[model samples]
Target: MTEAVFRETTADPRTQSVPLSHLSLELGHLYMEDFAAGPERLRRHFDEVRIWVEAARASAARRTGGKRPRISTCFLIDDYFTRFSTPAELVPLILKEAEEAGLVIDYLARESGCAVADRIELAESVMHRLVESPPPGSHGSRPPVSRTGWLANGQRTPTTRNALAEVTVWQPPQETAARNHSVFMDVELWSEKDGRRQWSCPFLAAVWQLARLGLLRHLGEPVLTPRPWDGEDFPHDWDRLPPLLRLNDSATPFSAYRTCTLVPNRFVAVEDAVRLILDQTDVDSGALRQVAERSAGEGAAVPAAVAQRATYVFYEEPIDSSLSEGT
Candidate 1:
């Protein structure tokens, strides 16, 4: 028998261990249209969110065996989709309204951060990691999601048929894991315009949720690590602001073993798509191992499945339905 030893240093990769809190609680999400309606919208949004915040904290404490759990509150602004007023003009208003409702936003993030944080193309990386759920009888002949730009909880209803096949009619899409009824969903991950790619909202939101769950990494290094902010004045341009900002110095760690997001009912479909995307993604194994180890050491371990680690509270939107049209 011949024994040879040839090893490459890069063969074994290590992930950066980020501080993981018990729960990362998302207080609310903001869109340009919400701001366009002025402070009243934000005031109403946070007022509704305040009660849910307390409830989420209590739930986290229960999960931690009634011990005081480390929970961090965060808010995401949709600066990627549409730019409204500058950060300088809009951020203070958001802060004031949230404060008035007795809610402190420990961290603030821009939606674009999930797309590209600190010069890393996070959305593209996540797109590459996606492992789509195959329907029954699939034999792995389908194109990868990176090329298809579409993901579904199950196989999409056929729009075309084999030229030589027998007579057929349109078929209804079916969920892969349906119990009795099928709730099929097909999500467009991105679209290209003039050679420039535009990621969909739900795709970006899934990356954002992965970041909050401490499950995201790029090339073995953590991405979207929060930068400290001491309540300083924000820049007039949205691009000047950091992707993730730590508004409160004494706040819990930004990354956590689990996450709870509170959003308006209008976002249910989007959030459902986010979960579907996450359900099939082959997340970074090194990061997953780290989270598992750290969480176990903390006494309350996270779930093995990434999608199961997220929770959401979809409350009623605090605005007139007609005024929210096209928003």
Candidate 2:
């Protein structure tokens, strides 16, 4: 396997200004690039990146616990690739990399290292693991234990399965409301099976597709928030979404859903554009009042401050009463 190389940069002289999350995000982008390239590429990148990250972590652990920290890592391969020979390969890759990172940090710590230096180093390592590991287990769970076999000493036991979900919002390109790859596309996807492509299905199919893609591999049910554009009629009228938009696997905001037009255009940097639009708004999102009336049940209440700025500009009329009921 080709090895990954993570060359260390000059230590930031100013440490207080950096956000670890931001660093993780930077690494996340780099990891995404490797993922898009190929598994061999990802493996090589992970090997190199894991060493650099662990070196940092080891430095930190020295200052904090005079010990090394081990990151337990795993990867979920896209299900469509299961039949292929390489589908099971990522499991060991993650395990090996995690072990290597932990070892590197130990070596770094034992060498001449200052607390500040160690902290910076360790922070980098943790961020590397964060980026290397898929987003925290946001998707649901593993499949069942086989059809139906349950018992505690011959007594039937209940078998449970967790639901997986996410919210993927879209942003549109400045010029038009058309779906384009330049403006959008997942940041990265593995190209196994000789560049085999995956198709996305709508509604339940969409959810199933996400599960198959390893995108919905969260270990728990997600806590969904209404999109800024979600109004009483939003869920009901979701069918009006473009065919591509209809393939959403989460409770993504209408604006975000519509942003898929940009995906095809390669404008996946929707966050940058959204930030720009938010800059133009005088309305304070944090202090907006609740505009919609309350629905019955023990659902979480929408904070008035947040609700005030919320708008339903894109939703169509409710077509399904079941959907409108908001289960």
Candidate 3:
């Protein structure tokens, strides 16, 4: 009788590796309401975004020492919290507006994919990895943030007290990394209805950034790898579309060393919360190492901190636009 020796090796496919671009530039995000308003809505948004996109590209070129940086553009549509139109009717319109603005969307993704990409419970997995940031006066004990579904920049002030309890002064929340003055923020991570759980927009958005940064993995395997779209007709249903779709055949890879999102001013606070989540969430070390090694091999300097790798440009929304929370 013989026994085979089990040894862990790097050759295992579980350690999924993805191609990386120098930058993943997000032109804008789409919502049902945004698109339903009309193509003019998409046009105005992209028209304003076109100039900023050039700025972002120029910035990336400088970072690469005047080299032609490999940049890929992506757009995300909100399909999880609220589904409005199918891919067939929505994608072409989005592409048309981007083209008119002299923009190219190399990749497109669905918001719900952040929650469950390719059948993987990505949001839940990220939730488990969240480690609350310790504020100035943090002790060994902390709040149950995952259960409570709330995350704050600093310790929260107690809002309730019994009459029998001793009187005390009100404590204002402080930002962990605040300067002389405090700019505190508290974000709700998710909500529950009946037995099902719904992830918040910021939380899903954070996951989306991680995926674009190539920092996510499922049991050592990459999640949400882009599916190629060869100009074939898009599906009538959202589920039929892949979590990530590569629209341009000549475009660079989906994942990148850094990401820059050019979104409406309305999403600035949401992106801030996303950065908060990234600062606290612990990503897979192996995946992080892979990104670093590959980037260095190409003589690029990727930021060490995952949270700092993402940047955003807050552009003014059109005067006629009405921004909604779900978007």
Candidates ranked by TM-score:
1, 3, 2
The runs of at least 3 residues in candidate 3 whose Cα sits more than 4 Å from the true structure, single-residue gaps closed, are 1-14, 139-142, 159-165, 321-327
Off by over 4 Å in 1: 1-7, 139-142, 159-168, 319-327
RMSD of each: 3.4, 27.2, 4.3
The local lDDT score (0 to 100) that residue 22 gets in candidate 3 is 96
Query: Can you rank all candidates by lDDT, best first?
Result: 1, 3, 2
List TM-scores for all candidates, in order.
0.92, 0.21, 0.90
lDDT of each: 0.90, 0.23, 0.89
Task: List pairs with backbone clashes in candidate 1.
Answer: none
Model 2 CA deviation exceeding 4 Å by range:
1-43, 51-74, 81-83, 86-90, 101-327
Model 2 lDDT tens row, 59-149: 4344334533222111222322122222124323434453554421110000001101212332112112211111222232322212111
Which lDDT tens digits does candidate 3 get at residues 160-262? 4556775665767778888898888889999999988999999999999999999899988889889888788999999999999999999999999999999
Model 3: number of clashes? 1
The true-structure Cα RMSD of candidate 1 reads: 3.4
Q: Candidate 1 or 2, higher lDDT?
A: 1
Worst 10 residues of 1 by lDDT: 159-168
